[model samples]
Target: MPYYMFQWKYKNEAVKALVQTPQDRAAELRKVVQAFGGRLHEFFFAFGDYDGVSIVEFPNNERCAACATTLTGAGANDLFRTTVLLTGDEAKAALAMANATNPDYAPPTGYTHHS
Candidate 1:
C-alpha cells in the first residue's frame, strides 16, 4: 500500500453545518476508504491553511487519485490537496539510489556545486 497525506479546508456551508451538528468525519471517510480497499491511519483537525489532515494508505496511486478527486469534487471543501508520503527507510533507499546514479550536467552560467 502507498501512503498519502490528505489536507482540506471546509467551505462556509460545511463549517456552518458542522457547527450545527458535529460529527466524527474520520468515521465517515473510513467507510469510503474501506470501500476502496484502503485504510485511514490518522485524522485530525489543524489550525493553518487547511482545516484538517488525514494519513491514509491505499492500494495504489490510481485509487488514491480517484478518492481524492471524488472528495474534492463533492463541493464541501474550499481547498483540498493530497501528498504522497515516504517512510524513513524508503527515503534512505532513495538517497542511496540517487547517490549511485546522479546525473552529470553543466550549470547554465557562473554556477558552482554547493556542498
Candidate 2:
C-alpha cells in the first residue's frame, strides 16, 4: 500500500457545517474513503493555514485520487495538498543513487570567489 499525507483547508461553508456537526465528520470521511478502498489513518485539527491533516493508505495513486475527487464533489470544496510518502529504506536507496554522480565534476564559474 502507498501512504499519503494530505493537508486540507475547508471552505467557509464546510467549516460552518463541520462546526455544527463535528462528531460525524470523521466517521463520514472514514466511510467515504473506505468505499474507495483506502484507509484513513490519522485526522487532526490544526491551528494554522489548513483546517486539518489526514494520513491515509491506499492500494495505489488512483484510489487516493478517487478519494480526493470525492471530497471535492461533495460540495465541501475543501482545498487539499497531498504528498506521497516513501519509506525510510526507499529514501536511503534514492540518496545513495544520487550520490553516485560524476566524481570528475569541476566547480562552475565564481566557485572560488567568497561572498
Scored by CA lDDT, what does every candidate get? Answer: 0.91, 0.83
TM-score of 2: 0.78
Q: Give the per-residue lDDT digits (tens) of candidate 2, residues 4-102.
A: 987888899888877887666677778988998999998888889888888889999999998888887776655788899989998998889778874
lDDT of 1 by residue, 10-74 (tens): 99999999999999899988888787788999999899899999999999998998888888888
Assess candidate 1 and give its lDDT.
Answer: 0.91
> Which sections of candidate 1 miss by over 4 Å?
106-115
lDDT of 2 at 20: 88
How far is 77's C-alpha from truth in model 1 (Å)?
0.3
Runs of candidate 2 with Cα error greater than 4 angstroms are: 100-115
User: Which window of 10 residues has the lowest lDDT sum in candidate 2?
Assistant: 70-79
Residue pairs with colliding backbones in model 2 are none
